[model samples]
Target: MSDDPKTLVSTDWLANHLKDPDLRVLDASWYLPDAGRDARAEYHAAHVPGARFFDIDEISDARSDLPHMAPPVEKFMSRMRRMGVGDGHQIVVYDGAGLLSAPRVWWLFKLMGHRDVAVLDGGFPKWQAEGRPTEDLAPVVKDRHLTVRYQNQLVRDVTQVSQASKLGTTQIVDARAAARFRGDAPEPREGLRAGHIPGARNVPFNTLLNTDQTMKSPDQLRTVFEGAGVDLSAPVITSCGSGITAAILGLALERIGHDRWSLYDGSWAEWGMFPTVPVATGDA
Candidate 1:
């Protein structure tokens, strides 16, 4: 399979190009509260050589009360500049939990209109397993400019999502676990309601991943979405508990050559908190 820098790159591809001057690797690891894994501490301990730590929580919109909403354009550009990541650089983001949170970072870069970004297939876990070179040292800081042409079409807010739900013209694909989607399990976060957005079809993110945590083939992915009752002809709005795993779904859609998809920035974090929006349980 070809490794597209704009989509997913393998460890082999990364190893061969590790020394490329224009390459920027990011350790964008994150986890839920109960996972008990410290992403920052783990990065400090060991990470891909020349990799910078991209803290999703810290780099997000601090002004938002909800969890890690999209950061403002100015903040995103400033943080990317501070990290020495800028225009003309090919960014490869990988997470500690295989492919968990890295795609979310990839989606964030796409939101900023930087299309030359990709998620590391199998992520840090596969790299470590393959005896790839890693280091604990921080990358050398250099001055770089990241021009922002933020693409609003790649992201949706609560208002847009609600309107789409009511219209039923667009497909809302939820990435949470089936249990969580069905209201059979409690949300990891407190004070949010169970169940999913009204008229949404459930396609749990893990179903799109292989046993090794790498994404499945494009054909396999197409089958997965079709099996989930998602109509490929309709526009898709991907969402999850806090808009993290939702990007995994978005990435899969991209891999399958579906360009008409957007991520819900607030996702269930904003949707579930509001009692005004209706929620549906027990499958779509």
Candidate 2:
């Protein structure tokens, strides 16, 4: 509906195009450990009609110690092929928690060089609230070959983030809350230090969303980023707790037409665990 089918889509757009042969809906629900909800169980209980479950954790780079690193090209291709999603298909990923976690999957599709993927604006909760159709049945699947280009430019490692932080050439935006960014609140994940990357600005992922959990308008999103001292002209590198919510920032940047951006995949999870990287605290 916003004319960017590769970034986001309204619930109305999805509902109207639900029966399209080339449309592939994915239930990509994931919750933080403390949230106490099982994503798989919930998907099995209810999901958008003809939607397939996309397990974020299971379909990732398991070799990495960090939580749910982006899956390798082969893994992504295999998983998507197994789900009957392939070239020429329009992907719409959604989560149980409105805007949460869905963007991660959307980003993944992009990183894997799939341009037709998009996140369901407002996700499952909003769809249900609007009285849209949902079903407990799993859709039939047929294998479809998937080709991945693997866009390395869309992801950043810890070393790259550290370099960017020290150089100040790029804007390092943290998606964690102000409290977490300032070390005023404890991290939800264990054994990680508080505070944020040096010179990084805080723009909590929630600040980019409206009350219904849909992303704010492009102009409003620009205002939110500018208010946080992010320079729109500079390239941006977004980071968050374990790189999950960071994709929310990435999506926001994409919505605002900021094409020169990447997600710090390691984020605070790796930076906070390492002794070599510097961490800054407070609102300075």
The TM-score values for the models, in the order shown, are 0.99, 0.98
lDDT of each: 0.94, 0.93
Which tens-of-lDDT digit does each residue in 236-266 have in candidate 2? 9999998889999999999999999999988
Model 1 spans > 4 angstroms off = none
Predicted structure with the largest lDDT when compared to the true one: 1
Encode model 1's per-residue lDDT on 87-196: one tens digit a residue. Answer: 99999999998999999999999999999999999999999999999898887889789999989899999999999999999999999999999999999888999999
Backbone clash pairs in model 2 (N, Cα, C under 3 Å; residues 3+ apart or in different chains), count: 0
Give the per-residue Cα lDDT of candidate 2 at 238.
91
Error of 2 at 186 (Å): 0.8
What does the lDDT come to for candidate 2? 0.93
